[model samples]
Target: MFKNIVRNIFLEAENANVKKYVKQISGADKLDPIIVIKPNPTWVANYGWIAYNNAMDQFAIYNLNNNQRRDKNSRCIFHFRDIQELHTVQDGICNRNLIPNGFHVPQGLQANIALGTNNPVPIGRAYLVINLEIKKLEFLEDKKFFYVD
Candidate 1:
């Protein structure tokens, strides 16, 4: 439910750049990335918060869990011109920690998150997945900033 709402808000955002990146990376020129966000459903999983942060930057993740490796999905990132992205990825994937995983945060998405009654024990260390390609990584920053609303 949250994803849908966020997606819709992004679609309507102004002074932001989500729509631009969608056209550049998606290569469809039809606003596909705006709705699908790179066509990856299971986008970005995390055992804890480590890979969750890394997926947004350029520290390309390698499945830490063996059995559930196949379940990993593309980490849906909200690339924006926030204070964090300004420093790191300045050259390309610099920071290794979020302090509080700062990059994963955009428009204060972290604040909106609620521990749904069932925060189950992690089944594996499959922390984070994303559909970004190594080549298009630099293009992330070019997108306009988007707020969750």
Candidate 2:
């Protein structure tokens, strides 16, 4: 299911700059990296989520730019705290705008979230899953930014 979604996203999009960045992050041979969400080893998985969230935030910035282009009278300054906040806010806005009643996922996905809930486990578990699609990785070939000097 995840693979299908990723494939769809890739097929339905075209972003040259983003593709270049991903290629730089991952090796040339490895075009699409499957990042799994795990409990242990905090850095890798968390960083993956952060990157995905950042990409979404970039999309929000594009949207804001579009709004500015469309409406001359509307002046809105949007500030985002990292990509995670942008993703959360964008998801909320999308749900509110698209869905009449609101969006609801199956219980299994969010059942573990219980930080403030009146349940046995007072502390909640933080977890995330994200899939990124790269159109092309050619820009990484000549880029030294991703390398450790």
Candidate 3:
């Protein structure tokens, strides 16, 4: 489950920074992503690791960011989708979960409904997939607005 799944995940990150780094090293982007027993997230950008996975806690949970070299040190190349398989059912809520009960999604984003997906591992949890930089992760309060597809 681990090896095959990770191999597939790496394939999904074909555009990962390691590929670009390897290309710059010796013109080869084929260096397979190395998986350490337990990786330190802070050391990721410094060591140029394509991905660094910290172990899951009691509930067995983790998250990943997109592929980008945001700072001068470590470039984050994590994708939250590939590793975790979200199997929650959206009963017309995820489409507009961010809006107030009486409100609705804007007409412009209505056509893009096909782009949304369910929450993470557990079902019925309100994991807002917003479009802003969240300094810290916290549960959404009632009647508040957030950006979601």
Candidate 4:
């Protein structure tokens, strides 16, 4: 599930000091970063997209800025070792219900929707809020994952 499912949650940070934040993430031992997944009321109110999951226990990062890593806004990508680390450090409940009314499913995830099944595998987006410090995240500038389409 970890390998193929949820990978990177693109955080769009505006007016934030990225260098300082990076230093805090790398230097401080007690820096517990809380990553808010979509379907988050606060996030939806402020930004406007609810990333809902369809499968139980399926956790994935919510892309906040919708991949617009531009205009003094930087994207923070946290690389986890595995699923265990993700589960151990995470500190929130994931809504496993299918995407509710009024939520726009991004074009990137349209292909992930299951075609025909009452119980579909978790091929769509996942919503999770995680603590980065406990997971011992590593910051990689050039690290990228490839998908076979």
**Candidate 2 per-residue lDDT over residues 22-108, each given as its tens digit:** 343343222232221111223224334444333333333444545432111111112333445545644654333331111223245
lDDT of 1 by residue, 20-134 (tens): 4343334422211221122112223423445444443232222223433211233333322233433233223313332222222243444565422122221112111123453
Most accurate candidate by TM-score: 4
Candidate RMSDs in order:
16.2, 15.8, 17.9, 12.7
**Could you give candidate 4's per-residue lDDT for residues 63-110 as a string of tens digits?**
223543211121222323444544442322223223232233334654
Q: Is candidate 3 or candidate 4 better by TM-score?
A: 4
lDDT of 3 by residue, 12-114 (tens): 4454644553232221122222111122333344332422221111012222234322112222221122112221212232343421221223456656655
Ranking by TM-score: 4, 2, 1, 3
* lDDT at position 12, candidate 2: 42
Q: Note the residue pairs that clash in candidate 4.
A: none
lDDT of 3: 0.26
Better of 1 and 3 by TM-score: 1
Off-target runs (Cα >4 Å) in candidate 1 are 1-14, 25-51, 57-149
TM-score of decoy 3: 0.16
| C-alpha local distance difference test of each model | 0.29, 0.29, 0.26, 0.30
Give me candidate 2's TM-score against the actual structure: 0.21
